[model samples]
Target: MLFTPTVIKNLLKKPATRLYPFTVREPFPNYRGELYIDIDACIFCGTCARKCPSQCIEVDKEQGLWSCDPHACVYCGICRDTCPTKCLHMKDVHRKPMTERIMMVEKGEPPKPKKKAAEAAPKAEAEPKADDADKGESKKADAKKK
Candidate 1:
Protein backbone atom coordinates (compact mmCIF):
# COMPACT_ATOMS: atom_id res chain seq x y z
CA MET A 1 0.00 0.00 0.00
CA LEU A 2 2.87 2.38 0.73
CA PHE A 3 4.52 1.72 -2.65
CA THR A 4 1.27 2.27 -4.50
CA PRO A 5 1.48 4.75 -7.43
CA THR A 6 -1.76 6.43 -6.29
CA VAL A 7 -0.18 7.27 -2.92
CA ILE A 8 2.96 8.56 -4.60
CA LYS A 9 0.92 10.66 -7.06
CA ASN A 10 -1.21 12.05 -4.24
CA LEU A 11 1.90 13.13 -2.37
CA LEU A 12 3.77 14.49 -5.41
CA LYS A 13 1.07 16.04 -7.67
CA LYS A 14 -1.90 18.37 -7.10
CA PRO A 15 -5.33 16.74 -6.64
CA ALA A 16 -6.97 15.74 -9.96
CA THR A 17 -10.44 16.44 -8.55
CA ARG A 18 -11.57 19.74 -7.13
CA LEU A 19 -13.45 20.19 -3.86
CA TYR A 20 -16.95 20.40 -5.41
CA PRO A 21 -18.65 22.28 -2.57
CA PHE A 22 -15.94 24.94 -2.65
CA THR A 23 -15.42 25.08 -6.42
CA VAL A 24 -18.63 25.50 -8.38
CA ARG A 25 -18.58 24.28 -11.99
CA GLU A 26 -20.57 26.11 -14.63
CA PRO A 27 -22.75 24.00 -16.87
CA PHE A 28 -22.04 23.85 -20.60
CA PRO A 29 -24.20 25.43 -23.29
CA ASN A 30 -27.37 23.62 -24.49
CA TYR A 31 -27.18 21.45 -21.39
CA ARG A 32 -30.52 19.91 -20.44
CA GLY A 33 -30.52 20.76 -16.76
CA GLU A 34 -33.17 20.92 -14.07
CA LEU A 35 -36.72 22.06 -14.87
CA TYR A 36 -37.96 25.62 -14.22
CA ILE A 37 -41.52 26.75 -14.88
CA ASP A 38 -42.84 30.27 -15.16
CA ILE A 39 -46.04 29.84 -13.22
CA ASP A 40 -47.42 33.24 -14.21
CA ALA A 41 -47.00 32.52 -17.90
CA CYS A 42 -48.28 28.97 -17.64
CA ILE A 43 -51.87 28.39 -18.82
CA PHE A 44 -52.45 25.45 -16.46
CA CYS A 45 -52.30 22.96 -19.35
CA GLY A 46 -51.25 19.36 -18.60
CA THR A 47 -49.12 19.18 -21.75
CA CYS A 48 -45.82 19.23 -19.87
CA ALA A 49 -46.87 16.52 -17.47
CA ARG A 50 -48.12 14.38 -20.35
CA LYS A 51 -44.90 14.81 -22.35
CA CYS A 52 -42.50 14.01 -19.49
CA PRO A 53 -41.02 10.53 -19.97
CA SER A 54 -40.15 10.26 -16.27
CA GLN A 55 -43.75 11.17 -15.34
CA CYS A 56 -42.40 13.31 -12.51
CA ILE A 57 -44.61 16.27 -13.48
CA GLU A 58 -48.20 16.50 -12.26
CA VAL A 59 -50.63 19.13 -13.55
CA ASP A 60 -54.03 19.70 -12.00
CA LYS A 61 -56.13 22.07 -14.14
CA GLU A 62 -59.20 22.09 -11.89
CA GLN A 63 -57.33 23.06 -8.73
CA GLY A 64 -54.75 25.00 -10.78
CA LEU A 65 -51.58 23.33 -9.54
CA TRP A 66 -48.47 22.40 -11.44
CA SER A 67 -46.11 20.17 -9.44
CA CYS A 68 -42.87 18.41 -10.21
CA ASP A 69 -41.04 15.81 -8.13
CA PRO A 70 -37.37 16.74 -8.39
CA HIS A 71 -36.23 13.40 -7.01
CA ALA A 72 -37.98 11.41 -9.70
CA CYS A 73 -37.16 13.79 -12.59
CA VAL A 74 -34.44 12.55 -14.95
CA TYR A 75 -33.79 16.04 -16.44
CA CYS A 76 -34.73 14.88 -19.93
CA GLY A 77 -36.10 18.33 -20.94
CA ILE A 78 -39.12 16.85 -22.67
CA CYS A 79 -41.51 18.89 -20.57
CA ARG A 80 -39.76 22.13 -21.44
CA ASP A 81 -39.70 21.30 -25.13
CA THR A 82 -43.37 20.33 -25.30
CA CYS A 83 -44.88 23.17 -23.25
CA PRO A 84 -47.45 24.97 -25.43
CA THR A 85 -47.17 28.28 -23.53
CA LYS A 86 -43.36 28.13 -23.58
CA CYS A 87 -43.30 28.69 -19.82
CA LEU A 88 -41.21 25.66 -18.93
CA HIS A 89 -37.50 26.17 -19.36
CA MET A 90 -34.39 24.04 -18.83
CA LYS A 91 -32.00 26.00 -16.67
CA ASP A 92 -28.22 25.48 -16.70
CA VAL A 93 -28.02 25.12 -12.90
CA HIS A 94 -29.41 22.15 -11.01
CA ARG A 95 -31.10 21.82 -7.64
CA LYS A 96 -28.87 21.49 -4.59
CA PRO A 97 -28.58 18.20 -2.74
CA MET A 98 -31.40 17.73 -0.29
CA THR A 99 -32.01 15.10 2.38
CA GLU A 100 -35.65 14.50 1.50
CA ARG A 101 -37.68 14.58 -1.69
CA ILE A 102 -39.73 17.73 -2.24
CA MET A 103 -42.45 18.31 -4.82
CA MET A 104 -42.42 21.83 -6.22
CA VAL A 105 -45.94 23.14 -6.63
CA GLU A 106 -47.17 26.36 -8.21
CA LYS A 107 -50.74 27.46 -7.69
CA GLY A 108 -52.73 29.57 -10.18
CA GLU A 109 -56.29 30.57 -10.97
CA PRO A 110 -58.54 27.83 -12.34
CA PRO A 111 -59.97 28.10 -15.85
CA LYS A 112 -63.53 29.44 -16.28
CA PRO A 113 -66.10 27.06 -17.73
CA LYS A 114 -67.85 27.95 -20.97
CA LYS A 115 -71.44 29.18 -20.92
CA LYS A 116 -73.94 26.49 -22.01
CA ALA A 117 -76.26 27.14 -25.00
CA ALA A 118 -79.39 26.91 -22.79
CA GLU A 119 -78.02 29.46 -20.31
CA ALA A 120 -76.86 31.81 -23.10
CA ALA A 121 -80.20 31.70 -24.96
CA PRO A 122 -82.15 33.07 -21.97
CA LYS A 123 -79.74 35.99 -21.54
CA ALA A 124 -79.94 36.94 -25.24
CA GLU A 125 -83.79 36.75 -25.18
CA ALA A 126 -83.99 38.94 -22.03
CA GLU A 127 -82.02 41.85 -23.55
CA PRO A 128 -84.01 44.10 -25.99
CA LYS A 129 -82.39 45.14 -29.27
CA ALA A 130 -81.66 48.93 -29.32
CA ASP A 131 -81.67 49.44 -33.14
CA ASP A 132 -85.39 49.43 -33.90
CA ALA A 133 -84.88 51.34 -37.19
CA ASP A 134 -82.50 48.66 -38.49
CA LYS A 135 -84.88 45.90 -37.38
CA GLY A 136 -87.89 47.58 -39.19
CA GLU A 137 -85.84 47.96 -42.39
CA SER A 138 -84.87 44.25 -42.28
CA LYS A 139 -88.52 43.29 -41.76
CA LYS A 140 -89.63 45.51 -44.73
CA ALA A 141 -86.94 43.88 -46.93
CA ASP A 142 -88.17 40.41 -45.86
CA ALA A 143 -91.81 41.39 -46.78
CA LYS A 144 -90.71 42.70 -50.25
CA LYS A 145 -88.71 39.48 -50.88
CA LYS A 146 -91.79 37.37 -49.89
Candidate 2:
Protein backbone atom coordinates (compact mmCIF):
# COMPACT_ATOMS: atom_id res chain seq x y z
CA MET A 1 0.00 0.00 0.00
CA LEU A 2 2.86 2.44 0.89
CA PHE A 3 4.88 1.40 -2.20
CA THR A 4 1.81 1.93 -4.39
CA PRO A 5 1.49 5.56 -3.28
CA THR A 6 5.26 6.21 -3.77
CA VAL A 7 5.19 4.75 -7.26
CA ILE A 8 2.10 6.86 -8.11
CA LYS A 9 3.86 10.03 -6.88
CA ASN A 10 7.01 9.29 -8.91
CA LEU A 11 5.02 8.53 -12.02
CA LEU A 12 3.19 11.88 -11.77
CA LYS A 13 6.44 13.90 -11.37
CA LYS A 14 8.15 15.40 -14.44
CA PRO A 15 11.34 13.81 -15.84
CA ALA A 16 14.60 15.05 -14.30
CA THR A 17 16.58 15.26 -17.55
CA ARG A 18 15.85 17.27 -20.68
CA LEU A 19 15.86 15.98 -24.28
CA TYR A 20 19.56 16.67 -24.84
CA PRO A 21 19.79 16.53 -28.62
CA PHE A 22 16.55 18.44 -29.12
CA THR A 23 17.25 21.06 -26.46
CA VAL A 24 20.93 21.84 -26.06
CA ARG A 25 21.97 23.85 -23.05
CA GLU A 26 23.82 27.11 -23.53
CA PRO A 27 27.53 26.96 -22.82
CA PHE A 28 28.85 28.69 -19.72
CA PRO A 29 30.71 31.99 -20.04
CA ASN A 30 34.46 31.72 -20.65
CA TYR A 31 34.09 28.03 -21.40
CA ARG A 32 37.07 26.61 -23.28
CA GLY A 33 35.37 24.52 -25.91
CA GLU A 34 37.11 24.68 -29.28
CA LEU A 35 40.61 25.76 -30.23
CA TYR A 36 41.36 28.09 -33.14
CA ILE A 37 44.20 30.23 -34.37
CA ASP A 38 44.53 33.63 -35.98
CA ILE A 39 47.25 32.74 -38.45
CA ASP A 40 48.07 36.32 -39.34
CA ALA A 41 49.03 37.13 -35.76
CA CYS A 42 50.94 33.91 -35.08
CA ILE A 43 54.75 34.15 -34.94
CA PHE A 44 55.38 30.38 -35.23
CA CYS A 45 57.51 30.56 -32.10
CA GLY A 46 56.59 26.91 -31.18
CA THR A 47 55.60 27.97 -27.68
CA CYS A 48 52.14 26.48 -28.17
CA ALA A 49 53.57 23.20 -29.40
CA ARG A 50 56.01 23.00 -26.54
CA LYS A 51 53.36 23.75 -23.94
CA CYS A 52 50.71 21.37 -25.22
CA PRO A 53 50.50 18.42 -22.86
CA SER A 54 49.04 16.17 -25.53
CA GLN A 55 51.66 17.18 -28.09
CA CYS A 56 49.04 17.72 -30.73
CA ILE A 57 50.43 21.00 -32.05
CA GLU A 58 53.15 21.26 -34.68
CA VAL A 59 54.93 24.38 -35.90
CA ASP A 60 57.25 24.83 -38.88
CA LYS A 61 58.91 28.23 -38.81
CA GLU A 62 60.61 27.83 -42.17
CA GLN A 63 57.36 26.85 -43.88
CA GLY A 64 55.32 29.21 -41.71
CA LEU A 65 52.88 26.39 -41.00
CA TRP A 66 50.94 25.66 -37.83
CA SER A 67 49.11 22.35 -37.57
CA CYS A 68 47.06 20.70 -34.85
CA ASP A 69 45.57 17.26 -34.49
CA PRO A 70 42.17 17.76 -32.96
CA HIS A 71 41.74 14.06 -32.23
CA ALA A 72 44.82 14.11 -30.05
CA CYS A 73 44.00 17.41 -28.35
CA VAL A 74 42.60 17.40 -24.83
CA TYR A 75 41.07 20.89 -25.09
CA CYS A 76 42.85 21.91 -21.89
CA GLY A 77 43.70 25.42 -23.23
CA ILE A 78 47.41 25.11 -22.42
CA CYS A 79 48.40 25.72 -26.03
CA ARG A 80 46.13 28.74 -26.16
CA ASP A 81 47.61 30.19 -22.98
CA THR A 82 51.25 29.74 -24.01
CA CYS A 83 50.98 31.34 -27.46
CA PRO A 84 53.30 34.38 -27.47
CA THR A 85 51.41 36.21 -30.21
CA LYS A 86 47.98 35.75 -28.58
CA CYS A 87 46.89 34.11 -31.81
CA LEU A 88 45.38 31.06 -30.14
CA HIS A 89 41.72 31.27 -29.10
CA MET A 90 38.98 29.02 -27.78
CA LYS A 91 35.32 29.27 -28.70
CA ASP A 92 32.44 28.76 -26.30
CA VAL A 93 30.96 25.96 -28.41
CA HIS A 94 32.64 22.58 -28.73
CA ARG A 95 33.87 21.12 -31.98
CA LYS A 96 31.26 19.23 -33.94
CA PRO A 97 31.34 15.47 -34.33
CA MET A 98 33.52 14.32 -37.17
CA THR A 99 33.31 11.15 -39.18
CA GLU A 100 36.91 11.26 -40.32
CA ARG A 101 40.19 12.52 -38.92
CA ILE A 102 41.37 15.92 -40.08
CA MET A 103 44.27 18.21 -39.36
CA MET A 104 43.95 21.91 -38.57
CA VAL A 105 46.63 23.68 -40.56
CA GLU A 106 47.33 27.38 -40.97
CA LYS A 107 49.89 28.98 -43.25
CA GLY A 108 51.31 32.44 -42.64
CA GLU A 109 54.17 34.62 -43.81
CA PRO A 110 57.49 33.74 -42.20
CA PRO A 111 59.32 36.36 -40.15
CA LYS A 112 62.01 38.24 -42.06
CA PRO A 113 65.66 37.61 -41.22
CA LYS A 114 67.37 40.24 -39.06
CA LYS A 115 70.19 42.37 -40.49
CA LYS A 116 73.73 41.25 -39.51
CA ALA A 117 75.99 43.55 -37.44
CA ALA A 118 78.84 43.08 -39.98
CA GLU A 119 76.56 44.36 -42.80
CA ALA A 120 75.50 47.39 -40.69
CA ALA A 121 79.07 48.36 -39.66
CA PRO A 122 80.18 49.17 -43.21
CA LYS A 123 77.23 51.52 -43.77
CA ALA A 124 78.24 53.57 -40.71
CA GLU A 125 81.93 53.70 -41.74
CA ALA A 126 81.08 54.90 -45.29
CA GLU A 127 79.23 58.05 -44.11
CA PRO A 128 82.07 60.28 -42.72
CA LYS A 129 81.42 64.04 -42.77
CA ALA A 130 83.97 66.62 -44.22
CA ASP A 131 84.53 68.20 -40.77
CA ASP A 132 85.17 64.72 -39.24
CA ALA A 133 87.62 63.90 -42.06
CA ASP A 134 89.58 67.15 -41.43
CA LYS A 135 89.72 66.38 -37.69
CA GLY A 136 91.05 62.86 -38.36
CA GLU A 137 93.78 64.23 -40.71
CA SER A 138 94.85 66.85 -38.13
CA LYS A 139 95.01 64.18 -35.41
CA LYS A 140 97.19 61.96 -37.65
CA ALA A 141 99.50 64.91 -38.52
CA ASP A 142 99.99 65.77 -34.84
CA ALA A 143 100.70 62.10 -34.02
CA LYS A 144 103.35 61.98 -36.86
CA LYS A 145 105.03 65.15 -35.53
CA LYS A 146 105.20 63.73 -32.00
Candidate lDDT (C-alpha), each: 0.76, 0.82
Best model per lDDT: 2
Hey, what RMSD does candidate 1 come out at?
18.7
Q: Native-vs-model 2 lDDT?
A: 0.82
Candidate 2 regions exceeding 4 Å error are 1-12, 117-146
Error of 2 at 19 (Å): 1.3
Model 1 misplaced regions, further than 4 Å: 1-16, 116-146
lDDT per residue (tens digit) for residues 1-146 in model 2: 76999889889999768899998888997999889999999987778876787768877766889999999899999888878778999999999999999999999996754567657754563454344446657966997999
- Go through the candidates in order and give the clash count of each: 0, 0
lDDT of 1 at 136: 46
TM-score on alpha carbons, each prediction: 0.64, 0.70
Model 2, 118: alpha-carbon shift in Å?
11
Tens-place lDDT per residue, model 1, 1-146, is 76798888889998789898899778887887777888888887678766777767777665779999888899988888788889998878877789986889989875654676656754563343224335546866997999
